[model samples]
Target: MPPSQELRRKAVNFKKGFKLKLEPEEIRKLEAVVEKATDQFTVEVAEKLRGLRVALNDVANSQIGADQAMQAIRSLSLEIKGMGGMFKYPLLTAFAKSLNDFTKDMGVPTPIQLDIIAAQIDALYVVMGNRIQGSGSKIEMQLLGALEEAARKYRHH
Candidate 1:
């Protein structure tokens, strides 16, 4: 048998990151900043919606770059999904998430799929245009339900 060797151990000093707690006043100030940024969010979302429309139109027209257009749609929807709830528009977040999910694996969408996409885009426009924040009204909920159902039913087809 070989001679036994002693083992050496090293201790690691893990440093704690920045403090996560915020004072009440800090929270209020942060909320005020968020509230003031809603107008900027509106402008950004409007621009993104315009890009969505242009991409959708490209897809609808059977352009040679349909794949790129679909990619653009996916990217824009994701951006919208990420920002909507931050501005207190959870409904917008929901709709954008639905759009993002529906188009996640899409390629050369069918007429019915295009129709669904168009409806989703229109719903987004209505939410932003009307400044419908939060979860919105009963009709809006119904619309969301219908869109989600349609997306689920036709996703694989």
Candidate 2:
């Protein structure tokens, strides 16, 4: 003989869904705030660049804690990559992404690789220092292409 068991099913309660609509004024206000934040992006990125530079210097000099410095470079480059486009600086984003990608799997970089890294860092500085928004000029594009080529050539060598 088998005993019968009762099965209870509970209905899931989902809160009512409402459409999220922002009024024109609210949208304008939000845009204004974003604009202000964008203006502050330079200062924040500059600080990060300084940190990157310090790490690069450490690596270049073969200083103690070079691994930690490499990690810092990777982390800062990633952060810069993430923030650049949000502030209307796609050029900066491109450079940061290049730097981040180059350093992603690197340990202690070779001297030539270090040179490539320095060039990328310098490109980032050029972008930010000139406030070059969007995709930048033809020459900048050429520079980016050259850096990418150099990175690829020296990556596995």
Candidate 3:
């Protein structure tokens, strides 16, 4: 057998409790399943992002109770942070993390902070609506940079 095959065989036969390695055919089958799941997830994420965009706008405009808005944003941001990578949208994850950090324990954000939040929400909307995946494209880079600058201006400490 070739060296690679020999190595794979050895790995499979190792006495220790290592996980079983899939044969080449099995690996291909598993990859197809993963691809299908990823595609479905991508489709689902668009709707979720649209909902988040609406919620974020509502939170921004709410004048009665900032706490309720904060709570809603917290939930949405956390969900985006957790799910963005699963759907192959790391830029969404990054934006969500930033928004999450900014909103942590923030009762009512200052006007400047609200501006930063609006920028983040808009960026996320653009990315999700356009179906931009991974780390985002060139235009996304510009958008993220501007949003980050706005965020930095309001970051306490």
Candidate 4:
């Protein structure tokens, strides 16, 4: 991230779906996304990011057909770029960065990698959501694992 608050102010990424301005209500809503989480609400926060991930996937998988996958990916990329930083999930922000970088070439994904990414995203939502709801599930565990890997792998390049 940029060191200066001014840069943070100026540097919101629309491509990743970070809104340029955060309304107080939206900030409050977002803060509620992690109200139940512990440890600075990181778990709660990542769960909130899962909502974006699912939305991104929906945008990505909007099937005109297989060819439409590229359009969806591009659209999702912009959303990820735009929102990643604004939402304050630095690790999620980094995942968006990694995805934006990896998919820039627009090659096809193997079934396994596609499976991995999609499943992990789903898992993220379940786990993070569970934390807020006072519960846990198998999917949530998997999501946590995926997040751990993502947190480790995503460097702030």
Candidate 5:
């Protein structure tokens, strides 16, 4: 089976067995924890962005093997993607996933492809720095659409 299909199947199976109801108090506590974590994440957002920049630099400079660089980019992308929504910046998640998919689909990228990746990363940095919120606002959607276009355009090359 394709990896995507297999992953979907596993996700379905996992969700099927994951039925838990949180009590009101427990829900409140969990929300509070999430809020606190989000706040802390905001404080360190620049550091996280720097880490991503470093990963991209390593890939661009060929300082690391392609496979290792890809892994690092994938790891950072997943981390940002997974946490973005939790912190109320779902656009960041979307952009990060675009970045992750681009890296995965492009294999060892060409210079042009690297430029695309860097563009996405820069866009992400803007979103994180500004704390853009929700799934997307009008301006955010426009920005995301542009990023998506760039990804699509380069993905086929």
Candidate 6:
């Protein structure tokens, strides 16, 4: 099966099993834990972005390393975008898709799409970084990141 279809299937099933624990206290605790996790996830994604920048900083210093970084960025960007779509977070998914195209265009430099994508990432960086860094955007960031991570693990196989 196509990876996308398989991921969607798994996500659907997982969502179905998310019943709260029978005890009220346990359910509340679970919610809190989930919330905390969500925030950390957003920050991690932001850090990953920074890592990409660091990796790409010396594109001229080592072309092979830069190329690998770019490839990883493309893969990670796609993974992020796919999670937004699966979870019905349209805005994030839309931006992620645009970002994915942006990284892909870096290789071919075609169709004038890279510039647009770059601008979008510049804007998103401000938000994603702030949220990831405990600037009050944690919950949203974490939810998005957690969802994406769940959906993308199969890709590593």
TM-score leader: 1
The C-alpha stretches of model 6 lying farther than 4 A from their native spots are 1-33, 58-62, 82-90, 105-117, 129-157
Go through the candidates in order and give each one's C-alpha lDDT. 0.93, 0.89, 0.74, 0.49, 0.80, 0.52
TM agreement with the true structure for every prediction: 0.86, 0.82, 0.70, 0.38, 0.77, 0.47
Q: What lDDT tens digits, residue by residue, belong to model 1 across residues 1-157?
A: 9554443123322454323577787788889998999889999999999999999999999859999999999999999999999998999999999999999999989989999999999999999999998999999999999999999998988
- How big is the positional error of residue 45 in model 6, measured in Å on the Cα after superposition? 1.4
* Model 6's TM-score against the true structure: 0.47
lDDT of model 4 at position 46: 55
Q: Lowest summed lDDT over 10 consecutive residues: which window, candidate 3?
A: 10-19
Candidate 6 lDDT tens digits, 65-148: 666766766776676666543333344555566556546646532223333434445545654544322222555556445434
1-157 in candidate 4: lDDT tens per residue? 7467886667765575547788898888887775434354454455445554654465456533434564455455456445534444343444445455544554444444455446445543443444333223455445555654653453221
* Tens-digit lDDT track of model 2 for 30-127: 77887889867888999999999999999999767889999999999999999998888988999999999999999899889899999999999999
What's the lDDT of the predicted structure labeled candidate 4?
Answer: 0.49
- Give candidate 2's error at residue 141 in angstroms: 0.8
lDDT of 4 at 20: 71
Model 3 Cα shift for residue 49 (angstroms):
2.8
RMSD to the hidden true structure, all candidates: 6.8, 6.9, 7.6, 12.4, 7.8, 12.0
Q: List the residue pairs that clash in candidate 6.
A: 38-142, 43-132
What C-alpha lDDT does candidate 5 achieve relative to the native structure? 0.80
Candidate 6 to native Cα RMSD, angstroms = 12.0
Q: Residue 100 error for model 5, in Å?
A: 0.9
lDDT per residue for candidate 3 within 1-157, as digits (tens), equals 5456865676665465434766788777766776678766766666666666666666678767667766777777888888887667899888888788777767777777777777777777777778788898787887777777767767762
Report the backbone clash tally of model 5: 0
